[model samples]
Target chain A: MAVDTRKCVGCSDCVVACQTENSVPIGFCRDWVVEVTDGTYPTLELELRSERCNHCDNSPCVRCCPTGASHYDKGGIVVVTHNKCIGCGACIASCPYDARYAHPDGYVDKCTFCLHRVEKGLLPSCVATCPTKCMYFGDLNDPKSPVSIMLKNRKYKTLIPEAGTKPQLYFLI
Target chain B: MREELIVSGRMNPFIDPHLNIWHWQIPLYLFLGGLAAGILFFAALFYLRGKENEYRAAVKIAPMIVPIILIIGLFALFLDLKHKAYFWHLYTVIRLQSPMSWGAWTLMIITPLSFIWAALHIKEVFPKWDWKYQWLKDIETFFQKYKKVIAWLMAIYSVILGVYTGILFSAFNARPLWNTSILGPLFLVSGLSTGTATAILFSKNHEERKTFARIDLLLIAIELFLIVHMFMGFLASTQVQIDAANLFLGGPYTAPFWMLVVAMGLIFPAVLEALELIKFRIPVYIPAILVLFGGIMLRFILAYAGQMSRWLY
Candidate 1:
């Protein structure tokens, strides 16, 4: 739920861990990183951030899905029901984060926050394998949760807040 | 742990790549859908006014397009699907928020209604031929009895079909180029314009030909206005919206948007039609063909520009 961009080394261990853990197809990813630079050459400021399915509060993919293929599961995490997807690509274009993909298996695929592991009381693959311990995941509703405490103590920002998708991911600057 | 700004403008080690999902199938579907809707709407309008007997060629050709082009369009859409076999899932449930749902249901209804619309005029299709089957005659008689209702339904659904093409793209909120509400009317007017052009090209009667030419000119003018409004609406919204406007203003899509969709599709046709309306008598087919070409180009350009206008990396 919360990430410290200041701590991300851009090693991409999390991306590799995710691909292996979720069996993401080659040349595709469930999570990735973005490196942006601002200002002039002599005084350039660089920012390294991991990006993936925002799992937004108001997910456009779910709303635009005609067959209920994409929907919100328990814990308010967005997911896809593979059998129901007609591979119309409507959800692919509808996602504000550009997170969803038309998997070769005839359905849309994206980050589920590792729901299979989460249900068994395990951290997401990205969080679990993050060597720098920069990735944090916990229910924001629980006051004592690590993500909640991090949010309380740190200044954070979300990507593309203007679009109004209300992304669950946070970057601790 | 600690990190530093190691280098200026360093590319992200992770690549969140762009996927080219919707191909020619989508644009072709949109074009054929608009064309079919336009033909039915115009023909049904003429029939309702009791002038169906006048524009013989337009009337005869129009109803035929509804079934033929619609099947082809639906086929193109089906081919684009990765789960082509699971397409039935779209029909089993209704999601009110989905434009695709509205489109699928409307197409189902329109296909049969269009077939009946053509069947009601069986005598026109074969003027001297006698029916070999009594059941066929009974079906035609039944359609004739409800011809007025059928005409109205066809007209109404044609507009829905035309506008639905625009709503389909406009529903993609993540794509700044397509998220505006104006796209619906812009596409509808474009459909009507193309339909009128097709009518002009095929109308056997001079009066019908002139009427369509005049109407098409007016539609072209409105279409130009809407195109301008579409960009202005985007430019007025947000930074992302402004960027969307810039995509046409001077971005990669500028050449096609201006050259194909604008100059060729709208302005050139408008000039030709205006000349025809003033009795200059330029060949009707030239402008008619231009309009049709422009209509298809518009759909293609919109599809590409919309998908390119993503909100994230």
Candidate 2:
């Protein structure tokens, strides 16, 4: 996933789209927007971007899950098997992104990159519904994919790279 | 330079304020698990050293409550699970790198062994404890025959259980307050101190109480040293880790952690125990109760504060 920070306007259309699409319980979210303001008044800078599970290449959540409920699917997307999860919250604590939440139905819930839609040959609801088209989703493994091309053409950074989870989400600067 | 992050559409209850999924249940469970492990470890150690007759409280009396403590601790863990029905999944596979997996398996093995170990000594504690069923009698006899072997196993598993209670939290690399190797030893020593305090409280003999007080004092010393070392490690590490150290230094957790856990729990009890050791008059129950209080407080502070410590703003 690639988020063009310059293009995102903090509209939160994607957040609503995700909630309506995924049936995420009210008061909880799998994805959200963050507006970062940096520097002094005259030289202040603002960056708005949507954030969700990074689906890290070396995900600590999957490694720390006691029941193997958290595991990587094809394309390195992290998914949690609801039935297998003991809802221990080990994965929740292990996530540096703080991307996971305990569902009211008693299981850990997080972004799956809309795997259900992806399997059906569609973009994640958040990406598809973005008003500004700032969020890009595609196979990072495929060099020819739009997300890969965007990464190659732009300066990009992953959040908290020092955490060493090798996060897959990229923010195009 | 100033920076501010205003996040919208970020209302996940626990994560929004801080990581708060683990609450009282986890800390309570850890304290109980550590206490049970401490009691079991001391019981096995004293028995193996052929001092069971001298340390009857440690070997017999204290262990008699282990089964109950463990069951309560397991219940606390079970309650903390969101999907309580699927807890059986914890046993279906083993992930060696996952400390929670190790903990689940350790609890499984040790819980049953604790019952058996306690059951084996029941007859000694209560001479009238007759096995009404023939199968029960046979099981007791079988355990008696291999009591020493069980003691050895319990000793090893108890250490694992004790250290594991702490390792479970420390395993989360994301939480800076808990991401340290010292937590394992710190928790183990604290468990031993609390366990010895319990034994002292139960012992009717002055000599037995004196022996446990001395051991408890030493364990408290080691615990304080490890805690100081942990703070130094945190302070000397990355900015995030230094931020974690500040939680106890002067952050939100300072007073409770310093007053309740360190001063009231470890230091005050150590002083009382020391005074008792030096022939000063002090009630055995005072320090014992204080140590036990401190043990649980330590877990509560760490669990809560660890959740609050994170790399991301």
Candidate 3:
């Protein structure tokens, strides 16, 4: 996933789209918007971007999960097997991005990159519903994919790269 | 200098301010697990050293309580689990890198061993006790024949269980406060100190009490040194770790951690034990209770404060 920060207007349409499409319970979310205001006083800069599970290549959640509940599906998407999860919350603590939450029905919940929809040849609800067309989702393994081209041509950064998670989500700077 | 404000629709309760998923149950479970480790370690250590008769409190009496403590601790853990019915899943697969998996397997092995160890010595603790069935007597006799082998295995597993209680927390690198190697040794020494305290409480022999007091004092000293070393390492490392150390340095956790865990738990108890060693007429229960209190407090403060330490903020 690549988010074009310059184009985001902080409208939160993706947030609504995800909630509606995934039927996420109230007071919980699979994805959300973050508006970062940086700088001193009047010399300020704002960057709005949608954030969700990084689905890191070195995901701590998968490594730390006691059972094989949290594991990588095809295309490197992290998914939780609800029935297998004991809901000990180890994955939630291991996540640097704070992307996972305890589902009320008693399991850890997080973004699956909308694999159900993507399997049927559709974009994720959040990417499909973004009015600004700022969110881009595709296989980074594909050299001609838009995400790969964007990273090649534009400056991009990942959240908390220092943690060494190798996040799959990128923000175009 | 730069500042940032994050305005979002992200309202996940525990994740907003910080990660706060673990609660009293986890800390309590760790405390009880460590305590069980300590008791079993001492029991096996004395048995292997041929001092089992001399340290009856450690080798026999203290172990009698281990099975009970472990069950209560496991119950607390079960209560904390969100998916109670699915806990059997923990045994379905074991992820070696996952501390929780190691913990679950360790508990499974140690819990049964504790019951068997205690049952083997039930006749010694209760003079009139006997096996009601012939098969039960045969089983007891078979175990008693190889009691030394059982003691050796128990000693090894006890240390693993002790260190594992701390490793469970330190394995999570995302939480800076708990992401240190020192926690394993720190928790092990603390467990040993608490276990000695329990032995001291149960022993009626003056010489045995004095012996455990000296050992507990040494263990307490090691625990304090490890704690100071942990903070020093934290302060010398990344900003996030420094923030973690500050939780007890001057942050909101300072009072409870410093006063309760350090002063009351280790220092005061050490002083009392020192006086007792010198033939001072101090009641044994006072220092024993203090050490136990401090052990649990250390877990509580760490579990809560670690949740408050993160890289994002």
Candidate 4:
């Protein structure tokens, strides 16, 4: 999905939206903004990128897990089976994108792109609530979807694209 | 919007935050397994020397250590588990591509074999059958024939346990400091050095002690050489790798890495082992304590060094 951070005014409505919609437990978020500022006071350029589970084509978290508790679910979502997890934290450590966390309960937790919501004909909580519309969700393979269309038209970058997770998310330049 | 939040949920911030599995825990299995191996190998040398007291002591204690180290490792692992009670599910790792899966499988195999092997060594510990029961003698003979075979297998398994931790560290390609190919050999050597020191320090006989002393001296010298080689490997690499190496040599984590590994681990053990060879005088338990301390330090340094990411790239 294409994320035009320029449109984002830094309001975290999207963050909270993701929360209530998916019932994400307190003290964690499935998607958020990363802000970077450069140059002196007068010349400062501030930029932000909203990020989530890249759901990469080739994921490291999948490889490092010993218990097979971490894997790709339907629609290419990187889902962690909390019940099956031994909480070894192998996946959390291996993820270069810093996408996963070993929750206090010891199971790996992260954004599943609101798979439950998607199954219910609703946009991801984050995408639906974005005040600035900075987050987008859609099948990367469908060339005609709004996300696929925007991805083709805009110059954007994915986090650590060189790592070859072939992330589905994008930061619109 | 006036954001009243003291801290954003978006950020994962904890002081010395446990980075999931990368928390401060130094995969204690390496140290414990090495300790077991150290004890068992020393026991073997005692057997070779025919020092019955040392052999009996070494054999008895060494076998006991196999389970202790395994249990210690299990405890460390469970402590790290998010679902501590569901820890038994670790045995269901059917995947071959995952090291955690392989480690779980190895642990299952190693624990049982260790119990059987240790059980075989303790003849008196086994339940005494009536003298008239003729079949029990065959069972005794069977354990004797396979004890050496089991010992060899145990040693190999021990090596796998030791080396596998290093391999686990290196698998984190994003963490370049841990990505060195030298890590596997480095860990294996560290295990041998630590284990041998443990064996020598704990032996019950003078000659039994001396044999492991020579081994201790040899291993310490080798480890010293290996330390140099590891540094050289880092120095020969990219700017990113060099900065990562500095985290160990004379950089931020240098104090723990050097003081613990070089001073407490390598130098002290070497000096103590040398006294046995030259002055022919050595303290009984002091050497063992120092050596085990050193081994622990070595692993502590290795682990600490690995976690310090240069991010120079």
How would you encode candidate 1's per-residue C-alpha lDDT over A1-173 as one tens digit per residue?
Answer: 88898998888887888889999877677887777777776787778887778899988899899899899998889999999999998988888777777777888888999999999999999999988999899898999999999999999999888887888999999
Question: What are the per-model DockQ values?
Answer: 0.49, 0.79, 0.73, 0.43
Which sequence of candidate numbers ranks them by lDDT, best first?
2, 3, 1, 4
lDDT of 1 by residue, B6-63 (tens): 2212222111334367889999999988888888888888888888778765676666
Candidate 2 chain B has its poorest 10 consecutive residues by lDDT at: B2-11
Q: Tell me the interface RMSD of every candidate, in Å.
A: 6.3, 1.2, 1.4, 5.8
Off by over 4 Å in 2: none
lDDT of each candidate versus the true structure: 0.85, 0.93, 0.91, 0.69
lDDT of 3 by residue, B207-259 (tens): 89999999999999999999989999999999889999998889999999999
Candidate 4 residue lDDT tens string, B133-176: 56755766776787667666666676676677667777765555
| Candidate 4 lDDT over residue span A40-155, tens digit each | 76777766666677887777788878877888888788888888888776776666566776566667688888888888988888888887777667887788887888888888
Report, in order, each candidate's fnat: 0.50, 0.83, 0.69, 0.40
**Tens-digit lDDT track for model 3 on A1-173?**
99999999888888888888888889998887787777788888888878899999999999999999999998999999999999999999998889999999999998989999999999999999988899888999998988899899999999999888889999999
RMSD versus native structure for model 4: 4.4
Superposition error at B64 for model 1 (Å): 1.1
For residue B263, model 3's alpha carbon misses the true position, in angstroms, by 0.4
- Residue-level lDDT of model 2, residues B60-175, one tens digit each, is 99999999999999999999999999999999999998999989999999999999988988988999898899999898988899999999999999999999999998888899
Summed backbone clashes in each candidate are 0, 0, 0, 4
* RMSD per model, one decimal: 3.2, 1.1, 1.1, 4.4
TM-score of chain A of each: 0.97, 0.98, 0.97, 0.92
